[model samples]
Target: MEKYIDIIKNSYSGYWNYLKNEIFFQNHWDNYFYGLIIISLLVWGLEILFPWRKNQSIFRKDFWLDTFYMFFNFFLLNLIILIALSNTAAEFLNDILSSVGLSLQSLQIFDVDNLPNWLGLFVFFIVSDFVQWNTHRLLHRVPFLWNFHKVHHSVKEMGFAAHLRYHWMEPVVYKSLLYLPIAIIGNYDAKDVAIVYFFTITIGHLNHANLGWDYGLFKYIVNNPKMHIWHHAKALPKHVRFGVNYGLTLSIWDYIFKTNYIPHNGKDIELGFSGDETFPKDFIKQELYPILSKNKDFD
Candidate 1:
């Protein structure tokens, strides 16, 4: 009981500290808040300079809503709820393992510490992205998870901020699945791989931006706006039911698994699901709609 209380207290305090540092731009180089803003601005600038759809407004439809979602999903929900809950869950799992005379190190498949720093970071990046790729597929295939994922597909107008405009439940789903595979790689500071995080963030923003970049020869390796727009297409191919282009950072996974589908340029593809017209436009309603509503024809 005392241990649980301590965990809760530590979680809150840690979150508070993180929040202060983020807002104040303390250690600005390592701050995700700054990173998000910089990446969004950089991508938005690209959209302004070279928009694929010239008719689309700079202040696009639901721009502010998506902007709010960016901060909400990235900071508010993550710091206030997800981080605390995750820390507590980790502690609880550790306790259970200890009771059985085991530890996380015992379960580790490889000690990354033995490898060179660059090699370890590379392994971590590959494993993490692959895990996320699989998880993204599950979000499309599973009805319950798809309900939550709809909040992301709800985007009609793609923008840089739209990249982060996902349901808060998504991080919970993502982090829950990410925990074990990361743990299996053994002890390594996430800070060491901060470059990977920022790189992925930049790619994600570009993937959802108004730009129509396919990375030319590297389109098959890295996900791009041209490829990802099809992922949110209103009409799926006749054979493909769940979803297509399930890559988060790397498109190689989709190519390797035969899930890659880019019929056309997809520069002006109609976005959103079939019933998205009826899907709640309000953020609160969208969050609750998945849990409270009975309509389950999500495809």
Candidate 2:
């Protein structure tokens, strides 16, 4: 119980640390909280203005649960990643690297920071997107991994909160694996990081939102609400060979891999896993559900 209380305390502290960093920045705007408030209000507004499922309640089943997940992700899970996982790994890895007389700065693959801001952000965006695309796919394809990934898919009602909804372990796999490639690039300034996150947070929420319509001419290049809606389709789309449309931001990857599938409309789509009634209905249980079940298959 002491450990649990400490973890919760760390969560609030971790979130507040980032929240207070704005004191050092020039602007009155707090980057993390400002983005959170703005994007959330925007997405919520859009969902209200043009909801695809008109009859679905604003406080649909698990609405507050997903809300809990969003804050949980923002605070507790993120704190765990930083305190229990990321910082420890960084310290240990740095020690090992120093022992071997290697440094990340000396091991730079390309001078990414020297590049034009726009181009640098662009390259990082693509690299991160592709990494996320593959991560998303692996979450679906790998059996044990799918058990944890299933938390996101268990949502029956789609909304902005669903975007941050994830199992606690997800950041470990994603951030740890991502460390390898980004470390080599080695040139991210604060602006570049902010730019990348701008699109990720905004575009990401919009994709999972209950809004319809493929992005017309841009549908093939950029991912849209319509294309992504099918990704959560109850049954896999016919002819989708291996977990279709895994792309997070750009649909081009799916197109090149022939995993793209967007029907004329997403009206008939039903969300969540097929026949997933046994899945936990509460947040705490959902967090524990993945570990409790040892089944390899996503059933």
Candidate 3:
């Protein structure tokens, strides 16, 4: 009980320090708060200059709502809630493993510490992206998970900020699944791989932006706006029932798994699910709907 109390107290202190650093712009280069803003501005500028959907307004519908989601998901929920919960869970798991004479180091598949930093980052990036790809597919295929994922698909007008417009529970799901795989790779400073993190953020923003880019020859390598727009298409393909383009950072997974579906340009495809019109519009209601509502027919 005392250990749990200490963990909670540490979480509060850590959260406070983190919030202060983000607000004050300390470690500006590595700060995700600054990174998000810079990336969003860059992508927004591109969208304004070369919008695929010309009629889409600069201040698109629900733009502010999505923007709020960006900060909420990226900072508030992630920093305050997830960090605390994950830390506590990690400590508890460590205690249990210690009692059994096992530790995380004993569970490592390979010693990532011996590898070059670049190689370590590369391996981590690939594995993490694959994990996320699978997690994304589950979110669509499973009705219960789909309820939470609906917050993201509710986007009617795609934009840069729309990238982070997701239910807070998503991080809980993603981090829970990502934790073990990442832990097995050995610990490394997040600052060492900030580039990969920023790269994914940029790609994610571009994927949701009103921009038409396929990365041309590299379309199969990296996910781009053209390919990802189809992922949000209101109507699923005749054969594909669950979803398509489940790739988060790389399109290679989709191609490798034969889930890549880009029948057309997808520049003007309708977005959102069938019953999206009835989905909660207010942020509070949207957050609670998945838990409270009796609508299980997310398919």
Candidate 4:
């Protein structure tokens, strides 16, 4: 057992050493945050051409409210990650990845080595998305955890900001749970992890977008605006559509779970919760009151 532990420790050391020395990763710290910029462009661009919700305006009061939620959660999650997982915990993750034939060192978006950037990007997005879909399903089903998740479901509209409009606790808890199995199974490095998150935020906006543009071949593999917009439907019988399109990069998991919802057949889906009077309006109140209120109706 001691020998096994030592082997793990050595692997961790090597992976951490690789990260500390990698020039491309060290040089591109800004790319992690740059994801938000690309996503903003995608939404703005789509809204200009083929908006799904014809009456929906992108710059209204609801948009700003949802934007605030996204920024708040993004900042909170980054702060927690830096303070809680940056040093020793990250090294431990590196060790675990190495054991699984994945190295935190190998997943960097750019490399001094000869690895293909495109393949790495593809793998990172696909795996991380599966992790997200499963985690999201668990959040909805698990009674105790659903309290935090309700913050997301409370939103009454579909927009770019609605994508990030999530309870702060949900990201922390769900992400932690989802990554454990992946860490044990895959070789995601810090840089690859960052790119995955970058794509996630971008794709997240695409999924929540109120626009109606179809990107052809990519739409099959990626969650386009229409498919995800349906997921936010406020109508009953259809509200359960929330369980589908969990992927930020691919629709494969949704298909496997039988949770995939395609909006092509019909299009009467409305966005937001059905019982508006029952759902909280203010963001702060929503978070606090859900803990106090018993959602017997959810039964």
Q: Candidate 1, which segments miss by more than 4 Å at Cα?
A: none
lDDT for 158 in candidate 1 is 90
CA deviation > 4 Å runs, candidate 4? 1-29, 80-121, 185-187, 236-242, 263-268
| Tens digits of per-residue lDDT for model 1, 1-299 | 88887887888888888888888858747688888888888899999999999999999999999999989988889667887789888888888899999988899999887899899988988999999999999999888999889999999989888898888889999999998888888868867777888999999999999998899989999999999999999898768878899999999999999999998778788999888888999889988988887656753
What local lDDT does model 3 show for residue 238? 66
Residue 33 local lDDT, model 4: 37
> If both were scored by TM-score, which would come out higher, candidate 1 or candidate 2?
1
TM-scores for the candidates: 0.96, 0.87, 0.96, 0.72
How much lDDT does each candidate structure score? 0.89, 0.76, 0.89, 0.63
Q: What would the per-residue lDDT of candidate 4 be over residues 156-272, giving only the tens digit for each residue?
A: 666677777876667666566655544444454666567567766777787777666446776667776767665665653545633555655576677677777774632346555
Inter-residue clash pairs, candidate 3: none
Question: Which of the two candidates, 3 or 4, achieves a greater TM-score against the reference?
Answer: 3
Candidate 3 Cα errors over 4 Å, as ranges: 25-27
**How good is model 1 by TM-score?**
0.96
The residue-level lDDT of candidate 1 at 83 comes to 73
- The order by descending lDDT is 1, 3, 2, 4
